[model samples]
Target chain A: MADLLRLDRDPAAALRETAQRAAVRDWTCATLGLGESATVLVTELSCAEPGCPPREVVIAVFAPHAPRRQCRIHCALAELDESRVRAAWLAPTPCGGSHD
Target chain B: MTDTNDKVPVTVLTGFLGAGKTTLLNRILTENHGQRIAVIENEFGEIGVDQELVINAEEEIFEMNNGCICCTVRGDLIRILGSLMKRRDRFDRIVVETTGMANPGPVAQTFFVDDDMRERFALDGIVTLVDARHFGQQVDANEEAREQVAFADVIVLNKTDLVTATELEAVERRVRAMNALARIVRSDPAARAAVPVDSVLGIGGFDLSRALEYKPTFLEPEYPFEWAGRFDLAAGRHELVLGEGPDPDMGLALFPAPPVEAEDPARVAAERAFKWFAEDVEANAPGTLLRPAESLAILDLQGTGSKRFPVQVDAPGRYWLVTQHLPEEFALALHDPQGRPVRPGLERAFAAGHTHDDEVGSISLETEEPLDPRRFSDWLSRELQAQGASIYRMKGFLNFKGVDQRVVIQGVHMLTDNTTLGPWGEKPRRTQLVFIGRNLDTQALIDGFDACLAD
Candidate 1:
């Protein structure tokens, strides 16, 4: 969890992070509209809960002087979709959750 | 120690002509960020190179080679990357610009499909830029455009400023319908601003990490010939028949099956009988057996490719019917044409394998024994020279006598690239090679490889 933002863990880890970020950025731009003041960051997290899948891609969007909004798609990078991304984006950001 | 992140990331950018790939490329290059990026653009048509720092790539974008990346220009890609590796600190990332009409399947597949490509390059993602103004018409009129969208991890709907908000939504919807999973972006290419360069360039989506689950066919067994099954047959007159398909080019032969009992007296007699039959067939005419036929191994067997053999068994023993390079699985009947039981109540065992399309397939040879490097080089050169056109790709890791490092061999058509992979790590050494091609002969390849084995 501490090194989740690190892209150098392995080839596969880098792939997961890069792919998730690209997808999240695309979804954010398409849904929230592209502007000069908007910045989007996508992060993939490993779920360590019992019976949960190993990882999920989370998206956080920040705009000019606004509170950060975070959302997550509980699936692999290849399975990320607009519907899922939008659902996660609309969901409230968890309190005290770390952002990469 | 080489870290996995040390491998350079390559982003394959694809889109139809006028898809704003150039706009996006220019934006990434000129941005204030201090990262060094190398751009490889496959020049097409009348379009001049837009990026000042661009590496020109050949425009010959070929079709998929053996369900993977195109090998036609793979050599060029390999050579370019090889040179790039020599000066490691120059570029932080690589962006490959494919022709608008090009299919992204092969380009993305190259990352994990080829050992060398996988070793040097980690695919970041496939970014397909789409012109929002004419995307609806282009997707409907062209299959290549549809394919580009289908394979993209990031779909940049460029020129969004030209389209109305409603049209923008419709274009996004159409792209989603074609590829439900791709990330979609509406790009206002007119805005001299950076178009989310950070999100697209370093994204690790192209890692082929989940390839096994997403595309199981990549792991599907690929071989020119499949060994069916070994059947236990009692010594007797029998006929071998093709089962369940149009006959393919095949070679069938019978070998003396081992005896059940180690000290059995019948085993010695059976070996002598087989030796007698071999001498008789070589000296006499085709399908001829010795005068004392009851003691002969086989009564008469001749011809190739789905022909019946009149086989005789002098003793109560076992035998094997080996089938080579054929679509049809062979089954041995206990009784002859008369329908009497040669061995009662024994069912035929068929090989558990299936056939693929006729155009391309693979042949793999794996052995624990070390190979003579010179002999293998000669055999491979001869094979590739005679049938290189039909042979699309060949790759293998081999053990060479007196060499400590693992020898890696890879080739597409006639062109080949060879190098040593440091050392054999903490694993047993073995030789494994696979050739994907058309019209493959398993026996010939097996014989050739056997000749390369160290004596």
Candidate 2:
């Protein structure tokens, strides 16, 4: 994804990334079998720490009574596919999420 | 990353109970700063007396969950900031008042750990108010008091008139020893946390250059060895006599000295000594011969009498003797083979192992070598996972192999953010990291960082 600040200067790019984020949120809600009460937040975080990808999409699923479930895809929001999201959420992960 | 100029600046206020947090908050609101400022107050108890004290601001309190159990960010803060951004033109800056018992780590980390918050807000600085009259007792009795001082960028010593001049000086010295980087400002006792408004506000404590622009002594790390002496010796055996004192064992290292005219000779010798200290110790009983080698030697001084350890000098040259503890502590002395006392031509004492609080202190590690990126990331992740609960704050500038730009990392507990500031250009490439926390193992941190060095 483009730099957050740079996207501010380029409105078209910002709009595109925002739309992609919304699409990811919808996909996460569907794949997780979340109900309307569940809050699904999809955010793209950029990290410069060594061994970390340049950008990753973090999907946090907060259900009504269950614990929060989070999964990350080491790619930009635009590049994320439905199958990848489905597999990531279906795979058994640790209590919080797979930080790797 | 967001442009700092476009984001709203936030100044966090944290201090112990009875410290002038509310006084400072009221002072900021009444002062003619020519800006509309919003205040966010976090009260500890159910009574909520602070909200009534604040003026000319809307009081909105929201309680929510911070998703992950280990994460410390207040969910209410995230919701409040999100709501405030909708009416961005209503305010120019923000000031958050944390309770006396609150740790400022979570409050500061919220600006960086959250994606939306990171883009919308900039943590300008953390101004800690310290009550001069009750500082000694509060710091001694409470851990939160010490943590607030350790994490402050600007410390306002309030209520100066309540204590004598000598008491104020002692408290200032103690605070300085605990945190060498904070800019200390004395407030008017009569005015109640009143100082120049510019001193607390507009100070870019989180900015890299501004954060590192404190005293030069802050860049100096606390050395492991306390004393180092330069001695010119002949190619013969020398006796190191030690009288019983504190511990049963003493760590020592001898290295060939660089030329006297060499630039930064002390630092040069220290670098070698640190590497040797990190290696496995060669344990020697009393009366055992210690030859000049590339490892640290541990002399066992178990008995209650003077112990003699022979040190062999293979070549006639100047050598440096570094001891883990001060020579005065153990009555350590050296004698040449001719039975003549050899006085050191040069002696230096390192500022080591002196802290305001025993459990809460800071560890600084510095190296000129560029670090391996992958190894550094792995080591940091593992460390934060294991010791995040105790680590209050961490900040550093690193030189990573294959990366030309300098990497700036700032972290609070488990959440960390690393960003490229700029290219190295003409400046020397170096990695400096400072960790402020409780029960920190200095050797373990040093060894872990050393392992990340690029081969």
What DockQ does predicted model 2 obtain?
Answer: 0.06
- Candidate 2 lDDT over A4-38, as tens digits, reads 11311367766777677767767788887767655
Most lDDT-accurate candidate: 2
Please give, for residues B1-455, the per-residue lDDT of candidate 2 as tens digits. Answer: 44686989999988999888887877777777897887777753332333322322222221112333225455456556655665678888988888888777667766765555676788989999999999999888988898898888889999998987657766776787666667788998777788888878888877656778754556666677777888899889899999986689888888788766567666677767877776675678999998776569999998789999888888999888888877877888999988687888988766564444547667788899988877788788777767776777787888888889887776766666666788999989999887877787778888999999998
Give the per-residue lDDT digits (tens) of candidate 1, residues B10-36: 988889988877767777877767778
Write down the RMSD of candidate 2 (Cα, Å): 11.4
So what's the TM-score on candidate 1? Answer: 0.37
Error of 1 at B156 (Å): 0.6
Task: Flag clash pairs in model 2.
Answer: none
- TM-score of candidate 2 on Cα atoms, chains taken together: 0.61
Candidate 2: list runs displaced more than 4 Å.
A1-100, B43-70, B221-356
